[model samples]
Target: MELIYMKKFLDACHQAKRITELMPKLPERMTPRHIHVIDALFQLEQKEDSVKVSDVSGFLGVTRPSITKLLNELESLGAVEKIPDEADRRVTLIRLTEKGKKYYNFYVEEYQGWLLKQLGEADTEEFMTTVNTIARVYKIVSDQKTAPVFPGEE
Candidate 1:
């Protein structure tokens, strides 16, 4: 890639990272990682009643310690519960509490989520530029049709 476009790309990447910070957030509190963990639990909730720590870890593809850390927070926040199965004393099952269900609902139910507000923030000219540049870059990388044509290429 050329130096000028590379510089702009880095700037856009930095802006994207701050996109979440720019928006109004949910009440229970969270980081990006926490969001994913909660989402995994919500997806699991849709499919199975026997949700265990192992099940969450499997869904997230993360190590036990990482899921455990998030689970501990979610449990303490009243968003989740960890209970030992009746038939097996050693196995623990995890599930969303009513508060958690509300929290997940808040994320999925609306255009109010920060990401959905991105398009509204950009003006017409800026939005078109971003879209066109992204399309050009995608075609260049995905199809290998040609070298990247930066913003003002002949």
Candidate 2:
């Protein structure tokens, strides 16, 4: 039973990946990872007065340097800007530019329209509930006990 379940899960993941590949291409110099960062920034913006690189890094469970590198690319693309915090000049905060907001809106509108068209209102709601259940399972598996890293192992 578990083997069958695992196979189905793996197949679903592959299908999801293929579907993403089929989605419309992003603008030049931008990729799916950039969109993920943009989405993270958008969500964090709603909850916090100011969003920091570390906050994004934590939210995405990625390294700060990775977030910084993506931010630099987005900055070059005029989608985001890094500004010094007013209260503390040493700390930097990130904010989406007008372009970023536009892109976020576009992506949301496109995805919602596509999903609704594909599944209809009732089925779309059910599909989302299933997806949310899978996400919870993933989080549980990721949080499973693991051996602690030694001081030098990393």
Best by TM-score: 2
lDDT of 1: 0.77
Q: Which ten residues in a row have the lowest lDDT in candidate 2?
A: 107-116
How high is each candidate's TM-score? 0.62, 0.77
lDDT of 1 by residue, 1-154 (tens): 6899888896886796686555447564566566567779989988996888988999876788889889998888888899989999998899889987786767654434545575566577877897798767656666755657678764
lDDT of 2 by residue, 52-82 (tens): 9999999999899999999999999999999
Model 1: weakest 10-residue lDDT segment is 107-116
The 0-to-1 C-alpha lDDT of every candidate, in the order given, reads 0.77, 0.86
Error of 1 at 115 (Å): 4.9
lDDT of 2 at 147: 42
Clashing pairs in 1: none
